[model samples]
Target: MTAMPMTDAPAPASGSRPLTRVLIANRGEIALRVIRACRDLGLASVAVYTAADARSAYVELADDAYRLEGTGPQETFLSIPALLAIAHRAGADAVHPGYGYLAESGEFAAAVTAAGLTWVGPSESAITALGDKTGARAVAEAVGAPIARGSAGAVDGVEEALRIAEEIGFPVAVKAVHGGGGRGFRTAADARELPTAFEAASREAAAAFGRGECLIEQQIVAPRHIETQCLADAHGTVRVLSTRDCSLQRRNQKVVEEAPAPGLTAEQEQVLAEASASILSHVGYVGAATCEFLLGADGRLSFMEANARIQVEHTVTEEVTGVDLVAWQLRIAAGERLPEAFPAPRGHAFQFRINAEDPAGGFFPSTGTITACREPAGPGVRMDSGVTEGFHVGTDFDPMLAKLVVTGEDREAALARSRRALDEYRLEGVATLLPLHRALVDAPAFAGSGHTVHTRWLEEDFMPGWTASLTPAEQNGAAAPAEDVEVVVEVDGHRLTVCVPAALAAPPAPERRRSRRISRRGTTVAQDISGLTAPMQGTIVAVDVSPGDRVSAGDRLAVIEAMKMEQPLKAPQDAVVKSVAVAAGAGVRSGDMLIEFED
Candidate 1:
């Protein structure tokens, strides 16, 4: 297919001017990422945080910081008025919406411009055109980009959805017109499942994005999720970076990303890169953008959607290409043109999203204070994080704790480095995806082969005990099967000894008649003192109260250090500290009691 040329006019000449201050309109790793980029460019940075994030590392690292009211996205991060006020107050010359929470919102982009601040992203028109999946598909088709054979517009209801599903063939995917990140999407194998899938998808889309309009598309089975990273400038210069394989996902959210996807033929790579550049330029694209494509089993590529803002996996591209995308965004927004030609990617790289989520517990979100976060450091290892050892991991925001990126000579080297980095990583206060990532990198399929969107699902169904077996030593006790005999044990490090139950010389057998009754007594007793147990594996940072100190409920007793965050252990009820088993600087496990209190 012949590609059309981009028609956007060149950006005004502002590259010569130095950027003085930048405001990060987002949080977490991405926000910290922008701050670092600004620092490298010799520009001041301002971080806007909610009450929950006031203690975040990003706030402390930035040149200036301010608090936004409310704890949630709607009440703070997504509030345009609040963001504008912050930018004005901070005297920020530019605003970078790291990604998500209005990153792709055209209204937000326009508002930033209206407030006389540079929006470090694509043109608002381009964002609007590509933000809506339906509109994006139309643009792609108009520009001769390959698209799935399905509805050309939004499906009105279940009846319309059924018709489109039939036309598109069985196993159609219903996606929210304005959705990303896997929410508001459902797949149906046949007509029997269409009604339920449509209803569920619409409801989810509405609840998540406040938009119910959905479009049905033929589900591409065994499709590899590949995306092209492109950087464009106001001068109409566009460069297509390497492609990334983000096929390792769960529920549509990417968990692992690698650049220069393995197993791609020279021709296939050329086709994708050329098509991506064609589409972006044809739309007069500017700033940083990612054109996502679903590479089919047959080697044909189809348009999925175009992300108008910086992506989470952009780090993988940066590591391979040696390009600072955030810096380029700021320059482009300041009216800089891309170099005569973009630099070619040099090596293989990968990025793992380190999240505080329990893979064994169905990937449930885990929250707590980080006590001792030890990030990996070495050649090709880069840690982009918004947290330190004393920060709190709150439930009010996304569970992502940081991103671990590694670069190497080739895919195999990158894989090896990733494994080594994962080994070096340590988080104490809460469960994280570390175990799952370790299992994934070690799996035969992952180690020996590239990936597709369905890869994680296949592994999840087949590798039942993979992640369950690698539970952190802190979570190991929680995963232990019920025990009987009511034995009190003294545990130090990995060693354990039975200290209680002097009447019993050995642990009771599982099938013994008295085992069941003894189990109840043991459970009750354990529960009573469980509160005294260390909430996670960490070193004691402080002991606010000592033995014999009378304390009311919620009084701070001690602080634990894990994953670079501080967790304060508080008294559960009015009581006197009878004995302090641990002092400041002592290390503890999840079930180790640090203090004893008198009732």
Candidate 2:
């Protein structure tokens, strides 16, 4: 492979007009994060939100806020037109697309530039080139970065995919060309599973990304998922930040990330860092980016893909490097050059994604209002959040409610801090990953043992002990007094002695019947709706009814955007639409009137 010729042009000089106003074209913790950075830099901050996120903390903290059309990601955050309009209306000089949504979208980047706004990210060309997995593989190979063995480009269909799978050997991975976050990905152990895996992956890819093209690659069993944070300037200067180990993952999404990977030999660390820098220079990459790689059991590192925007796990890298990546992104986009040399990372750090998910029940997504929230504090702890007590954790966007980050002098210290932080973190009104993370950090396997990404998910020994170690007091409510036991009870002639001390035997609280009330005095009730209420909070993406429209049971009424997933609210009974309460692009809360049915 021929090396791409390096351009000799010096980095662009910093813009004459410093950033005055910045608009965050994203939601959740990341949006709040950018707003805080703007505050530190003395720049005015603007937040754009869908109706679903109007109450988010980020919106309240911003200097100005705009309501975008549509409740879902596609209609709000990912809508290029909506974002540009917000930037223009807010008089924002720069637009920051936080990670996820359109953060890596080349089209959005170009649009921002065309609108004469600073795009606080990598160049559109670089994003487009590296966004496609197959194209990225080619680039990595060309730059002498190790790439996984696979088909040269996207496979045509099941037959082509099968052929590639066979050539790559059994246990291959079928991945979407435009996929991220582990969506549109599947693995097949052998030829028999190829067809099914291919069809499923293709359908998912088409639905998730509107792309059906896929590529086959050899699945690296027992591989550690590691990535290096890289920064570059327009002058072509690239520097490698500290490396992160994101091995604790579920369903291809990282749950915990730690910086300065543990158990790596000095030589291996240097090699990985250099390789990452080389690739960034080759691509003329600018802004903050992460180069993902799979460290195989044989100690060989294979480049996976390059994330063309700031990563969710970047906070961990920040704790170690003492560099604000988001700020650097803003500086780079404004044509400022990086420092002459990169500084070595200083301590160990870890970040845990606090998501509203139930680990006991298959990690199913949970959404509701956060009735109580108590964040961890003390030395070495930092919290980045989008919600507060009373803020609804609706189904309108990603389930991640906050990020808990900690830093320490070494890995053990970081681990201890993480454990303490998780123990102190309290959230109610919705299930969260706190319990799961606490259990994980306390486990013997995770305490000091080095494990890979695959090890956490596939290793048999690591699964059973997660919930087993919980004490009765921890599993239930607060501990009961020792004297509170010793009572005699008889059931079916069998006598049982139960002891309850005075301290523990408090009088039972009175139970009050919940009042069922519907308030419609001020608001007009739609007369023509016979559909089930939306099961979650979301933005209406597609409205299938209008006033006086007829519908049948099971008919699709509207598609709601929640947690980045689209769910259709269907008619529960046949009825005529007396009035449609919601229009496409409107946000709705659970039990919010959508359409009225004629009686």
Candidate 3:
């Protein structure tokens, strides 16, 4: 692929304009990351937060902190005016949007630039051109990068989506034109699934990015998710720093990632590097960006999309390449030039996303106060965390609590180190993926240098019979009666616990047996046999069942939107809905009744 002609872009900052202060328009670990970078450069950092994050670590670490008065994301971090106002009040000379929220919004970038503050990312024009999915595809096509067949641009509606899906063949992906981090991405195996997928993708895109427009593409079957970390300067230089494999995923979200994607041939690496550089240079993109691709088992590469801002897995690339991508984003925004070449990647690195989710329960988002936390540390291990003991994890935003990255001289060594790090890590009062991470590091499909895993490996293969074993804390994490006797046991590597009457354990028959049952099922519907209740906190986006409606097992009864993803609540068995307890758009708690069934 050859670099195409450049588009109109903002003029480069005049001769290395220095930045004195930077406003971080985000929350959590990323905000703390940018604050640390600002400190490294001797630049004052300003932090903004909602009521939920008022006492977050990032706020206290920043040089100045302000509050954005509101509860939800729209009223807080996603509000451009609110962020700009904070920047103005803090006398911030630059704005850094650390992933998610308005990070990929061209409007936000333009607004910051219009306010005379440097935008620490690609130029607004670059973002406008490439941030949009359809525009990105067009750019890729112009540069002759390999791309999957799909619609030219956003489809008109579900009908149009169906038509496009058919023309491109079934098993199409409906993707949001804006945003990243898998917020608005869905796959439909056939026509029966396309409508729901389209609607869900659009709704999520609109809510997450303030844009509902979506484009359809032919789904790549069982491909490794590969991406290249790229850096660009205003002086017409683009560097493809490293390749990363985010093949281990669930719910279309990456769970594990590594740098210099394993098992890539020399030719594949060359193609990825060239195509990424060409695409960014063609759009006059500046600062840090990532170009993603799908590598088929047959050794073919297909362009996926370009992320305009830094990504969650940049840590893996940094570990292997020894580069601080966030600091480079700041330097590039301040008119610094990139070196002609970056050092070749070394060794191996892996990043495990420590999400506040219950792996045993279909990765459903979990929230609670962090009653205890023990982060890992040692040679070749780094923990980028956002929460602390006493910090409350909520469903109002992404459930990721932190990133655990480990590196070593090689892939095998890295995997071994990851196992140790995961064992050292611990948390309480909230369900997490820690046990899953511990298991994944040693799984046959993920371990060793010759491992074969794809984007759907976790969902399709690894999780089929996999179950998460609870720690002693997790077993006792929930409140229980003082009279309840808890007994824990392990059978065939599966942990099982029971709290029952004292007589039951005495080898004698009791007049009555009272016990609490535990089930490892998807946490969208209640476990009760008579009715369905919400298993987590969220808002009901749709109600597919009504009173007297007949439903069979596995039929979607409703959908709950939480943590920017939609989880479908399904009927547990054949039943007629006797009554509906919750309406669409209603907020619900863990035990709130959603539907009732007659005996």
Candidate 4:
């Protein structure tokens, strides 16, 4: 639907401002999405990049680009001052925070408005009301939306959390008050697991969102993850565009999502749409937002939370509904009003996130340069990518390299298309989720007619039996090079099809190789396999073992934080800790010694 002219209706707190140049305070595919939207609206787009992201695809496509002048995220994307200064330098009249980073930061929104620039999102007050989990829950309750039993507010400590969990029953979820994208979300099956889950969740929350306060909620076991894509304008119009199913997850994070959630009855659809519109309307929210819920086996819907920004899976909705959600964010911020109604959902679409992770290695994050890249193309295939061939995938950011969206006339057709698209898609250089996605399309649980998959189905039912291998890039770069292709370089008069021995290959290219002494699989500590070593580059978040501590095989020793996920290092064999080398918060590279085992 087209936008109507601005009227005398009461506008959102962020009043309409003239649109010209828009600065995107984000990176990767989402930034590219916003840039294309700006171009479609005849507006100039400005891009900001960190030192590591200088060669990203979005930076090159932007009308103007500015260097963030920083080494990491804290000094670049998460720095309010840096982003604002770049906005001023670019002469941008508006700032669009594509999802993540400071996208949900109310302070950032207020600061943008204070600087007399348009914030292309919900008003500051609206974000503040909904950004906090407790406030969002209250709003949902006030609006008569369905909700599950949860703590009154953010719990004080583990004791308080346990008390709340007891009151709500076991099998509960510990969620960060300011968490999104499943960063600080954890689950507990019993009282014994609550404390560790709580502490880890809080530490992760502090690292990701700068807040440690969390709330406890009753877990809806084995439920389908459903959310409604809602859009509101300054003129008080809220439209529920479509419903999506994001139940296929790993470690509480979504991997595959489909638009127009399948198997929902007419009543369930009405409930989702009504509740979504009511929650946003109650908060006087403007711009795009999502209301999440859990549909139980009994067909009851329970409110989960609300996200105050565009989501990574929003592309599937756009494909099926024929609505340009990103463009609407720009137009709505420029004082345009939404029409009375939106078109009904048309076709079915599925989105697969291609993350740089090794599924066989327990989804370990893999870092390497993109040696080869090939995307799929057909009537119903779309690839939104941030990297090109030769672009390096590192541990500095999220593991998601791109998204693959496939659409068809129906769910069956969409699944068929997804199979073709996934097979046709080819990417090398780093390990990714391509293999797992290929397996998912044909899995009995996923392709079954009754929709048997749930939130925990991936880890509990699927992954335990599934297995994949390292990509060619993983073996070539992270380990020793594969057998060299023979070529004759006239050496003395002899033409030789020489194959360089693996032992003689250039010490395994420093930048590409993970560790000099560790094995290719990162299981052995050194050439002799005498100690434990880090498997990837990341920060040590926790060290459970100390010097002189005796540990058995498979005992937890430490935890490493990389690509926003925590990986626990376990003792490979029964041994006494001879010494400890790394401490919590220490940065480490692959093959770096962490603890030495006694003889």
Candidate 5:
């Protein structure tokens, strides 16, 4: 195991209100994950769900369930008051903010503690300090860890960003001060792209993290993304489980992860462990956390930021280290001491995220009920999912369907296991990343020297041109009808549920909401220059041009916020704006016209 220093904080007394119940303030896979952890620890789990997730698989698995009245996150998961109320009603002794939504919210942590509920995470002060990208950079510097050369703190405006961009040179990354999973990251190769990148990054940051603060850093060309997994108890004992290589990514979001990252020297490993331990110790962080760093081609390691909560890829670490990270979080929160040190790595482990996206169609999100489902089984293959055969994937939450983790004695064996697992995984109704993962494991580049591939290799080099052939209908822009949906409606604080048979099917996809176009076979219709239409469903956050405005082919005519990313709608050709069809804050669908241009 990775090494660190010892501490003397006392454990909570055995008689001090032992935690027997936990309320999960999240949804989907992570909620199920926490419930399983609670079960393993002989504790009961309560779940909270929004109207959109009333039938989620995880909610059904929890010991008890409570409904929060709303659809989107703001009215459900992100609502601190609503979550606390559920805890009170459920008689929950603690709350587990599983991974997204409020997992890293310092305010939520403070609120949970103030409500006299145990929060299964680090202290609020630590969350506030390390959760802020800019603040974490400062902490890294103070702890003698190397950090990238860039802005000293959060950038305020375009002018300030321009100055920082000049100082950091070209090919700079505009990153949110409180973002992860690449949700709030953008790169600008030159000054021309800086303004758009900065604004989009800031907006994405605000939408995802509720903070628009950003910082500019020089993009480390072709660097490897590595992180150290840490488990610390209230007693100040912090143990590093293993290093994970999250180099396989798309748009900064990790796609594939493995433990004991390939191609690192002993010295590199030592430095990573030391750097992670130093930061976690300095902040007095407790529970589960991970310290991220970027390893450059020259072998220099620069601290990126710290995830103050257990990360999505923690399973890879668990696979290699034989440690239960979520259980550790619960134990540490209950003031129990961890083992003095964790065991050494036993085998190589790989994790592939199964996202509900159509890789053949620009990775667009696909939502529908899973008509059929099957998963890989047997030794060394594990699936952690909150989805099943009848599960309905929706747009109100993250697109991930589940995670597949596999282990073997070595990298080659692990790759073989992963290939078998991918082959065994079968599902119908919605598209997934399964085929992409299948191709990667079989590719010679990924099997041999490909082990060291960088984050951009997949999307930029391979995936764009890869064959995701499924059916002529799917490729030629014909989508199967959405299955009939049955919903449970609440009336007078009572439950009323309605079920519709799949054969009945729902109405033809709304006239203005064509779900997809531009498939792998390249058969989708071309856009009409006389009118501008939304490319996908999202909220129109801005209209950049007005009627009668002249614009070039490349001008950004508008911006849409969807899935927490800011997508720019650009002009297809030089044209004069005839009319603005949609207003700011309007809800739009893929085929909804947003602007009209002069013929």
Candidate 6:
């Protein structure tokens, strides 16, 4: 659709600004998500995009497009002033920050409030108190919700963290009080590792969220991750949608999420619902929010943290509860109350994140132009995707390309349907986790009522050994190396010989980089790293060492930011820094050099 010119209709002269026109301050599926919600409400929509996202599908779907000049999220989506200006330029009276980027930023919310634009999220005070884990734990405790035994609040320093860890016992998790998406979290098994992990987690939190405060929590061994979906209004009414199981994860990032969590008894479910309602009601929370909890296989639950915005896995809850959450968010922001009755969860729902990652290659990003694509459909299947053929997958944002949500009368039926749906999903040019997901749904461990899954279960039990048996061709789409020579000979009576062109073989080079893997022959395989190459594609955020500085085995060399995760490049062994190859803010590709070290 072509862009529509801005209309001059003024906002309603009322208590809260009515969402006549909404300016979307995010990109990808979520931008489309908010736009669709606006369509459902008969509200005009304005969409914004950075230069990189100019060709995005969501950009064209909006009634109006406000083009912003930038490439990365920092200069585009996360720029609050730019978003506010776009809201004004598009004559938008409301702004919706779809989950990532600046979704949980209290400053952004306050700024929107100051600008008199309807911010479709919780109040600034609620976000400030609940967005941080330490603050949320306190609020949960205040409402009589069960939280893990740990620190009173944000710990001051290593000294304070050490004290808390001592009281909580060993194997405690030091987390970024201001962090989300598991970015600035670390686990220390004992006192010897406490200070280092604490310092690292703090630095990462400061680098990512601009806040250095941290909290200590006792690690729940082999615990399932569960979350409750909730909605509150300008009034005091709070509705508990449903609960989800989000324990299938890698590096603390959830990969698969399901609603009406598997093993909880009726009593447990009631307890969860009551506790969530009490917490939100006490905090005076407004709009869509989620309360995360940690549960053991024995059915014990502990509230972990709270997200003040719609979560990535909200679709599964919607599929089960039959609630249009985003629409309710807009309605709630426009001063509407929840419906008198919510449909009790009718069926089981599952959402699998279709990420641009190579599962066999340690789940590293596999970004490029998507050559072809097809999403599953035809009954109980939903694909909330943002890309089509020729879409460029970049590292500037999150790697998830889409989500595949399927529902059935029960968990068994959902699993059966999910298997067929995974087989139907076909995409090329960019590697995906389809194969891994297919295996998971087909595995017996996930049969009947589904199985218990913990946070580390995927990485620990599934990923490592699963990939070893597959040939390189089966893992990556790469075909086997061509044979050295091809010969054609007639064996019947006539002798005829033809020699075809052939590839070469050589002695393998020594392993020196993160990408190198030992061949089956025990030969050291080189992975094309010239000198101190980058492990992944991202912009350099910091360069710590000089050309001639001596460094230890664990000294930090530099920091690279990709997909909101900060990857620190540390020296593998003691050496002198021969030369610094890249400067801060320079974008580097996988296997591109960042620093060279002299042995």
Q: What is the lDDT of residue 553 in candidate 6?
A: 63
Q: Which 10 residues in a row give candidate 4 its minimum summed lDDT?
A: 510-519
**lDDT: which is higher, 1 or 3?**
3
Error of 6 at 301 (Å): 1.3
Output the number of the TM-score-best candidate: 3
lDDT for residue 508 in candidate 5, whole number 0-100: 28
Candidate 4 RMSD to the real structure: 6.2
Kindly list the per-residue Cα lDDT of model 3 for residues 359-423, writing each as its tens digit. Answer: 77778888889888889999999989999999998888989999999999999999889988987
TM for every model, in the order presented, reads 0.77, 0.79, 0.90, 0.89, 0.86, 0.84
Q: What C-alpha lDDT, on a 0 to 100 scale, does residue 137 get in candidate 1?
A: 92
Worst lDDT window (10 residues) for model 3? 1-10
Model 1 Cα shift for residue 378 (angstroms): 1.2
Per residue, candidate 2 scores C-alpha lDDT tens digits across 43-143 of 78899887777788888988999999775567777789988988998888888888874888888888998899888887788887888898799888887
**Candidate 5 lDDT, tens digit per residue, 1-599?**
11111123244634223567899998889999998988877788999987767788888888899999876778888899999999999888899999985889899999988998989998889998898898899889888998889999899898999988998798898999896878789999999999988988887788788788899999888788999999877767788889999988887878889998988999999999888988998888888999999988788998999998889999999999888899878877877788877899888999999998766655656677888888898789999988888888766678888999999999999998998888788877887888678777766556686465776777676765565542224323555443334445689989975444444435422211113222443311235778778766778888999999999876778887666555566777789999998887898887898989988
Local lDDT at 500 for model 4: 49
Tell me the spans in candidate 4 whose CA falls farther than 4 Å from its real position: 1-14, 469-528
Off by over 4 Å in 1: 1-18, 449-465, 470-599
Candidate 6: the clashing residue pairs are none
lDDT score, residue 239, model 6? 92
RMSD of each: 13.2, 10.7, 7.4, 6.2, 9.1, 6.8
In terms of lDDT, model 6 sits at 0.79
* Residue 11 displacement in candidate 1 (angstroms): 10
Backbone-clash count (model 6): 0
Candidate 3: stretches off by over 4 Å: 1-12, 470-519, 522-525
